[model samples]
Target: MMLVLLLLIYTSQHALAVVVEMNAGEMSVLLPCQFSGFIPDDPTVMWTRNDLVPKSVHVQHKEGDDFQGQNQRYRGRTKMRPDALDTSDFSLTLRKPEMTDSGNYTCSISGGRGERTLEDVELQIKDQQVEVKVVEGSDSVILPCKTKHDLPEDTRVEWTRSNPELMLVHIYPHKSDQRKKQDGLYRDRTAVNKDLLRTGDLSLTLKHPTERDSGGYICTIYRDKDILRQKVVLQVKGWFPPWATALLVLLVLFVVSGGLLFHFRHYFMSVYKVEVDSGVESVLLPCKTVAHLPEDVKVEWMDSDDKKVHVYQSSSDHSDEKHQVYRNRTEMKRNLLRTGDLSLTLKHPTNEDNSTYTCTVYNREGNILLKKDVLLAVRVPQVEVDSGVESVQLPLKTTLHLPEDAKIEWKDSDDDHLHVYEKRFDQLEQQDQVYKDRTKMNEDLLRTGDLSLTLKHPTDGDNRTYTCTVYSKEGNILLRKKLELKVKGRVQVQDQTGDIRNRSSSIDPTPLMADQSV
Candidate 1:
């Protein structure tokens, strides 16, 4: 009985000291040991990294039993999977492995059976660097799957194009570091799709593109553990076709042909007709030349006598000798090519100044255009007056004067209304009205320009104003003068003394008789 008990204890001790050989990359390798030898119920399981020693052990207590492990990098990341705990599995699961986590790990537990240790668990961690591919101009590009694993936060991504003509447009952390060439045509027209930075999408787009942009491109991912590369072929198609090119050429030809036709019509075929107002103080003679003509073209103006009246050369400074009667008054309306305001101004016009004028434009290529026979007319009007306030009484008549062609008419001051004079020239002569007998004029003095209308019996009522108006042949009222009628002296008075003495004598006869008796 003693030998059987001893043999059972030795088998349990050998089983408790079993090796926990963990082959690298296994899902969850069991640390070839169990807690059944200790307490069949709850027992502590512990693990530790040899690199971290005792200081980095993770400890867990179940009732009075304790388990511990020293793995600072894997501190809370290790746990006994709940499903495996019921089967005496004392194995720990690493949530995610990193390159820095490769080392030896051990599991130890102290309980009712005895203190047991599982040694030399070679935890070999490897980084499966994933393959990423970037297909240029494809639907999309994918980043390497290695980025999905646990990696250092400071890891960087680099994108490069394998083709010499193609280049990296932009990258994160730096915009200026993006590959660019001074002589490249797309120098400023490329940009990256920055919205997908989180998911590791590094894509770029070109603006106003051409087919030459199609080429191979590369995207390289740089991590602390490894580096990754991807290649993509970009395919491009022409935006414009052969038909579009032909249409563009035709459009340019049509524009040039139309411009030439317009130039021919303006320079060789167009005509301008000019008319000037008669009797004006001066006349403006307008002349227009083709806008395409050079600024150095010379314009000459000539009168009917073939005398050069004015000369305008754009290259020469302004001179009075080259100007017509009105110096500095003649001006082009606007810049030569803008508006043909070659309208000239004349000053102090007269009848002799009326004639046909000619405008000739000459360039270095000889006479280019001409405008002929523009007529200008000047007019004058004669002055005459048809009215009569010919004369007044002695004192008033002395202050009056008249012109040679004056006519006379008479009317009473009270009857003088504007409409009263609207009678026929002959009817005025046949009238024997109140003014007929009262007024007269000296017929012989009229030839000497003396229009004196004498009033026979002038009275105070005649003290009013009379107008003498002179008119031009054009019916223009040229001159007007007003005459005032005046009367001099006072009136005589008669006495009523005798009748007043008689009335007083009859009313007071008693006082008179008393005075007589005394």
Candidate 2:
């Protein structure tokens, strides 16, 4: 039974341990240590620092304990909660952390076999804020990333380039550890505080920092497997401020104000181009006036046929055309007296919808306030043959039928200056030297837009990219296809003795002979 009880106590003790975590730059922190299987009796807990002569202390649950040692830096600053001990809370609170207060600390219990555990807390103190000013092409300026934290003796602090393209001038931890490079323009300009490494003072000094160095920089502190990082920005400036800097600033403000006025005037007066996708059910056309006009102003929307779609005069009255095609499709969104929201929306679209619409606004005095026009282009997909395909063979030629209104243009890729056939004009009988007597299209299919051209003598050199562009009253459409020519030829040689040998004798020789002769 005694052995069983001992095993239970051991398991409970192992299950209950203390944990301490300190955030960077935290001044006060609670180091909570848990003690399981507590009897609630008067327990004695003590804390100590890891130093040459460790500062130790003892505390009682009833009366508070203060453990300020001969180290004047941490005097009268450590304490623990009174109720924490009764509830098995052995947490220690450190006050006002300093550079000297960084190291491993231990929390131990003197009751029930005297158990103790050690944990380390790292304290990082940020460096003083610095302002850097440097000029372009001037001498290198040094910006330091420093801190005031006491680190381990063998800790390594480094200054690495945040941007790899920029080279490091130098890194100094000691006089003998100075690194210098000849090729880098900033070779002899960078340095750091070497003596402060053990104390976690990672201050970086940049030498000859250029305008390119006006970015982020990192200072890293490495100790064993732990790392602490800090970042700072180095700004490069041109020159210093003078007594008349305020006047110069005012002058700049005046110039900027004038420039903004000019820009707004130009933007208000300039005509804006409106583009819309085809098949759109509705579109809002924006028309806004610059300044205030008389409340009794008139606005109207006119289509290409000079037909009035909608008209608005005064704030309460609107005129509509009953017989218009777009009777319910268009309306004015706002009044011109307050907001110039002359935006209009079209309800449904049709192929006959291709036209340029005009927005005209007139003031009460019958003077034109604003006049703007927007071209509405509706688009449809049309299949057509591109320009560069000089010829098509027998099998491919049968697939040349296209839909209606498909515009086809044929031009030689080798010589674009020559036109093979234009839809508005008849086909040219004579071809250019490059395509001489080699290209022709089916005459009957030409009326229906079958623009498949056939080459008499196809060659590999005729392979080229052909662009087929189709235009409609709505808009323009484009498609591209590549044509590659593969020619098959037969050669025959007859001796004077009348002995004739046939090339490809089994095949019909007429087509091959005719193509080769061309």
Candidate 3:
């Protein structure tokens, strides 16, 4: 018994051990192993993963490489040097690794005498995390999935939700999408690119996504024996109107209309409603005042959290005193003091930038001189439609009736006027030529408050952001909305059986858990 124990210990010493780490979407990774000294003729090299059935990962002999006993997961993804045994190098190359491929692998060698352990390799594969947030009433949202490798033509793509519950969201097999087995919750709500494999962009578009649809989604691509997966988290927030603030604003307007503007001149500050897309490079916070102020006064902009956004003093900019969140991202006009236009330009504004900003002017003694408040709503609601559709509508619904003399204008990101309305009628004189006859609106939009624009014959060129602005006769912006339009090419799919084969070892999804080390 002692001799047998000694022999086992001796055999363990011959096995070289190593560990490798790689991300899930990577192209390939190498498990290294090297042996020196004599190599017998007609030798055999074998690799196996103990936990997997049909443990054979790869095998090679004097004849050539063999796959008769290999596991289905490693059928077409495992490779080694042609002259591995002759050179005593028994490394293996794994292509398109996935989260399920993390484990321990054993390598062995045999010849005329007997078999012996060669090496042991431990692999750890991790998935990259991505998060996307959208408002509850958005038309659609995209869960992006991009891969580096060129997958096979016959690859099968499967999108599944693992968080909250295990469910199948979408599937594309062979050359078309299969929806029969899709979860009822995602029925008629999911779409993918027509030529995903060719473009390497397998982004999944979810239409009319609600808060219930928010969760962790896994996009798994199956190409023959290889499985690649990536994870994305989606968050949908519900919209709630601030009723008290709206009532206060109405009271302020009532007081101003009663010729009491002079009484509230020191207390009332004009509010400007600014809406912009999150994808925009910059947004201007308008705070113009005609009141003359002391030359030694300081202008400071602050967010709802009272964090300094931008500051100007001593006849120059003082960005060092701004909050770290706005560092290097806030700018002001050079002649703000001269022009009395204390507009703050914020760069690369995101969802986190959505809040009310206060601009306060202070004298040399730190006493408030004048103040203005600007409410910035950075929203980019996406609306996707197929090019085959006859027309697409940019929806904007408000319960309150707009001013009768208000001029509503619809303009694209390129400054092209898509539609215009003034004096309760369509104003086509200033409309862009490209949208002269392609745009339409309701007859009494001022009363109905449904300023949705319908664009006929949507095409790829129509893919851009459209901004809707309502201005009163005094040239004050009353309302603004930004909507992103995506016109995708139509996809033609035929009814056929989902050509699925060589599914991953763990076909049924397991709950997203912490990473395991082997």
TM-score of 2: 0.26
Candidate achieving higher TM-score, 1 or 3: 3
lDDT by residue for model 2 over 1-518, one digit each (tens)?
99999999867644343323233343465554556755434556767664636466334444566454434455576677787667766766767655555555566665556555533333343443345666644645565555454566666655554453434434444344344321133344455665675544566665545455676555655554344555556777534456456765665567666766445442333444444543344666667643344456677787778988678776653545523677656666655545656766764443345677788877554656578876665443222222234444421122433445444445444534122444544346534577566656566554454545565544434444332233333433222222333333333545567676545332224534544422
Q: What is the Cα-based lDDT of residue 268 in candidate 1?
A: 32
How much does candidate 3 score in TM-score?
0.29
User: Where does candidate 3 clash, by residue pair?
Assistant: none
Query: Which prediction has the highest lDDT against the true structure?
Result: 3
What is the C-alpha lDDT profile of model 1 across 1-518, one tens digit per residue?
99999999967754434232222333433333344543435556667665664644455555322334444565556666454445656666665555566655567765657657744354445444333333223333333222342334554555444454444543434445443321233344445544434555554454433344456544445444233434445555543466877886676567566766454432233443334422233467766532233355666677778766766776452556553453442444446433544556654344446677777767534644445445665543222221233334421132234444443343333435211111112124444454555554444543353434556555444555544333333433333334455543232222354232222111112333434322
Q: Sorted by lDDT, highest first, which candidate order results?
A: 3, 2, 1
Candidate 1's C-alpha runs over 4 A off are 1-281, 289-291, 315-318, 323-329, 384-518
lDDT of 3 by residue, 4-89 (tens): 99998866743334556556776677777678756677788899998999899999998889999999999799999998877788
Spell out the clash pairs found in candidate 2: 140-208, 141-208, 142-206, 145-204, 386-468, 391-453, 392-453
Q: Of models 1 and 2, which has the larger lDDT? A: 2
> TM-score rank, highest first?
3, 2, 1
Model 1 clashes, total count? 15
